[model samples]
Target: MPPNPTSYDTASEMAGGPGTLEGMKRLWTPAWIARHVAMVVLVVGFLCLGWWQVTRAASGNTLSFGYAIEWPVFAGFVVFVWWREVRHTLRGTRTERPTPAPSATAGSEPAAATAGVRRPVRVSRVPVPGDGVQDGDLAEYNRYLSWLNANPDAKPGDYPG
Candidate 1:
């Protein structure tokens, strides 16, 4: 028998409302279905055992031994099935494809300015120390010096203008 919808629905909704096919796929995967099936089987088996024992008592038949034997066998079967499902899930399926990076727009400023010194400084040519003077490095350093030189309301000796 299928699970009661109201319980499953409330459970699913609490777990994020069945947003996508991938989410749905995870919910109803073979491993998941097998686990639920095993659980239902165990519940039914136990109920049947209880009913049988009660009915035997009513009929003045001592079914204690019969129930004790049958319940364990059914329970073992259910446990074996559940173990298989757990192993299958642990082995795992449904690999996620790598998500692509978003396209950059011309209007969007790169985070270089706000990001400050931690950001990668793209020098036209990286300077090799003791390789005389690199023009690109000299140019960038001069631009920085000029900016430092001009700001009037700056602190006095902090960066000598």
Candidate 2:
């Protein structure tokens, strides 16, 4: 079978192997360079904001103490995410795609069964007004609702139903 076009192995091979100069060069494409620049800017901005917060905290603003910790944590998170993306790129792993829903009309088997679901969900049909086929429990509930509507100020506990 032909290799999948979306596979990372194919992409790496096209770039002249993952460890080679050409493969490394592929990481500096316009999109990747933009991403790298953005990550650096965000990390630096967060660190600067953290420093400003720290200075404010030192000047006796209690609220700035929490923000000082928060900004540094945000910077760390940005670094962590950048590192993770680079690692994933080097390892050639693609993000997972969501599985499509099974077609209800495609086969004799139930859609849930075809999709590997153990139990099929049962949906009760909603009754339209003046349907002439009224369920006893539903009728009783509707009567209780009518009583509540008629006596708006009455407590729910006072409902005879």
Candidate 3:
């Protein structure tokens, strides 16, 4: 006789089987697709930049060789970030749950010191690394802006700029 099919078996299979791919499959939302497309464009842009730099080197500019290498590095970094973002998005829901607090030597984990800082109770945007986000005191910002204004060459000075 054939074995009986129970809800337990079905749930167990779903929890451990090919159904895990569901998150990966459903990952192709518009935003996800857009990010992939953008990543591709970024890679192509990097290749073009590298090629342009190489050609500049061929035409006798010594600085272009460094750029040729740098552009490809930029492409690799973009691909790395894109892959990380995808993986993070897929796993985020599952792994975002808070873990149990540690005791005693938990101080070794280095918690943020809030002693002098007035952090907003409401959740706000936290900047990602390498995103170049700067937000804080208005007066300091104004001072920075004035410094930039005084420096003539401060604006948009990156390689792509």
Candidate 4:
């Protein structure tokens, strides 16, 4: 069964399918009309610029040849972006969401400090014999790290070698 037109999830669907005359009419809204006008102006402006570059190139400014090609490519990019935005507007899908502010309490730690923060986990490693590293050196390094972790305020030079 065909879905009821009025029961659509988006404004575009409510007007009609995207390619239909009715749907196109929806694009005539003030904001969309402004966008349409802007796109037209940009495309025309770019083409004119390209044409100017082409004339300059013909007059023997070699650099203008590259500019002539670039301006037209810029026009194509503007059209592509405009088309993408139009499609997204028609789909009525939002790309971003508002983030909630962190809450604070009297005599409590700041939310920023606790939120999304993880404490590092200590892993114990068993020394493999004949791994080219002396086991005694590995054990001494592990002991040094443990001492550093335990005495957060102590300077490295304070550790007895």
| Ranking of all predicted structures according to TM-score, beginning with the best and ending with the worst | 2, 3, 4, 1
Model 4: CA > 4 A from native: 1-15, 93-161
lDDT of 3 by residue, 1-161 (tens): 65576523553235323237665664678988898899999999999999999999999999999999999999999999997887667655353446655453754764545448765698658945664655558557676667777777756352131
Candidate 2 lDDT, 32-133, residue by residue in tens: 999899999999999999999999999999999999999989999999998888767765633345788766675566555344647668987994568678
lDDT of 4 by residue, 38-126 (tens): 99999999999999999999999999999999999999999999999888665553334458767778898766554678778988797
Off by over 4 Å in 1: 1-27, 54-59, 93-161
- Positional deviation of residue 118's Cα in model 1 after best superposition, in angstroms: 58
User: Pairs clashing in candidate 4?
Assistant: none
Query: What is the Cα-based TM-score of model 4?
Result: 0.47
Clashing pairs in 3: none
lDDT of 1 at 21: 45
Instruction: Give Cα-based local distance difference scores for all models.
Output: 0.63, 0.81, 0.73, 0.81
Two-way TM-score contest, 2 vs 4, winner: 2
Tell me how candidate 4 scores on lDDT. 0.81
Better of 3 and 4 by lDDT: 4
lDDT of 3: 0.73
Q: How close is candidate 1 to the true structure, as a TM-score?
A: 0.31
